[model samples]
Target: MISELVMVPTDEAVLTGDLVVPGHVPAVVLFAHGSGSSRLSVRNRAAAAELHKAGLGTLLLDLLSEREEREDAATARHRFDIPLLSRRLVAALEWLAQEPNTRDLPAGLFGASTGAAAALMAAAERPERVYAVVSRGGRPDLAGDAIERVAAPVLLIVGGSDEAVLGLNREAAERLSAPHEIHVVPGATHLFPEPGALEEVAEVAGRWFLAHLKERRGPGGRRA
Candidate 1:
């Protein structure tokens, strides 16, 4: 496996990211962290590790620069700026497409919290590039009309005990025109901090990405 630090250039700033690829990987998963979180998030890291073990490459990125993170921490503005985040994500995806190590691999998005909205919007914008999407404890509703435009298969994972967010996910799922499903982790809350709860999420997410990515790849490791 190879792990490298990558700087993704966006229109406004250069975002830092960690790119890890296992030997002979056929697909890659890009993570979109939630509000107030970064590439160092333990939960997202755990999920990425599992996906790697499942033979998928993973890219975890910081959506904001150091100065932007500090400013957003104070004003809480950039975290909820879905369009800005989506554009940044799109830029990262474009960068991946040009990179030799990951360009040939199918790409998927795993988003958490508001990042989920950005992931959905980006997937909608680049329908042919994104093979699948998974949202963990995310607000897909925040993507607005972009939800209806998404062409990739989507999996929405929510905590069983997080009634408020579960409701929001349900409403958002209704607007999706793509193949989608909602999975609830019993006894888990919005963060899925309960024992074994996050592992369940990782398992479901890994399976979903692998299955869909492989399907998209088809025979002879070529895009179908």
Candidate 2:
């Protein structure tokens, strides 16, 4: 396994992340954290651990620089800047392609909250590289027109009780032309704090990645 702290250089700033890839894993899932969250998010860490059990790699990144995070915390700025976030994510994906350990493996994305929208945008921008996408309590509606361009299969995981976001997810699902599904965690809230709720999210997400990431795309951008 390769586990380390890495720096991803973007046009504007350098982002820090924790990368862990087990030996012989099929794919690496890059995590896009929600507003105000970081690479150290407990929920995301738990989910990454679960993915590891499925022989998948994971990279948990802070989409913001330290200065930007502090500023966002105080003024609530930068977190909702979907374009900036998506650009940073796209940069990370490019960096991963150049990284020695992950260069040959297919990649997937796991986004949470607003980060989901950014992930979708990045996927739209780099369709040939991203094999699949998974969103956890995500705001895919925020992706706007980019949702229609994503070529990879997608999985939307929402808490059953997060009604407003669930409705938004349903609307976004309708806009997506790519293969997709929505999995609702019964009685769980937006953060899935309920007992066993997050575990369920991790399990289902792991399974989805296992199924989709292993398949190669054939002609006309369809899964083979």
Candidate 3:
């Protein structure tokens, strides 16, 4: 596997990220970390490792800059700004499309918490670019009408013990227009901190992305 530190330009800021690509990768998964998290998130990194082992490329991006994150940490202002976050995610996707290494690969998204809303919104906006989406303990209901516009297949994975979020995922699933499913991880909480719970999340997510991303690929292994 090859790992590179990349700076992705957006309208307002140049976000930093780690792009990891394994040999013979067919697809790339962009991770949208939840509120109060960055590319250094342990869970997201763990999941990315699993995806890499599955022969997929991964981008773990810090959606917010250091200054912006500090500001949000102080005021909690930008964390829930779905439109802003979506724009940044879309910018990253555009950048990826232009990069030689990942330009031809189908793209998928892995979102957690509020980042799921941004991921969904980005998917809705770029239906031709994104092929699949997986949300781990996500708040998809926060996506509102944008959820209905997403064409890519979505898999919402929530912890069974996290009743409130599970309910939210169920409600969002009802509003989805594309193929979608809600998978509840038993004995796990909002963070899936229980032993083996996070592994389950990673396994399910890897399978979902591998299947859907490959299915969405165009001729000669390019993104359709």
Best by TM-score: 1
**Candidate 1 structure quality by residue, lDDT tens digits, 41-108:** 99999999999999899999999999999999999989999999999999989999999999987789
Candidate 1: what lDDT?
0.96
Candidate numbers, best lDDT first, in rank order: 1, 2, 3
Q: Tens-digit lDDT track for model 3 on 158-183?
A: 99999999999999999999999999
TM-score for all models, in order of appearance: 0.99, 0.96, 0.97
- For each of the candidates, give the backbone clash count: 0, 0, 0
Which window of 10 residues has the lowest lDDT sum in candidate 1?
Answer: 213-222
| Poorly placed runs, candidate 3 (over 4 Å) | 218-224
Candidate 3, 125: how far from true, in Å? 0.5
- lDDT (0 to 1) per candidate: 0.96, 0.94, 0.94
Q: Which 10 consecutive residues of model 3 have the lowest summed lDDT?
A: 215-224
Better of 1 and 2 by TM-score: 1
The TM-score ranking, best first, is 1, 3, 2
What's the distance in Å from true for residue 160, model 3?
0.4
Task: Name the lDDT value of residue 203 in candidate 2.
Answer: 99
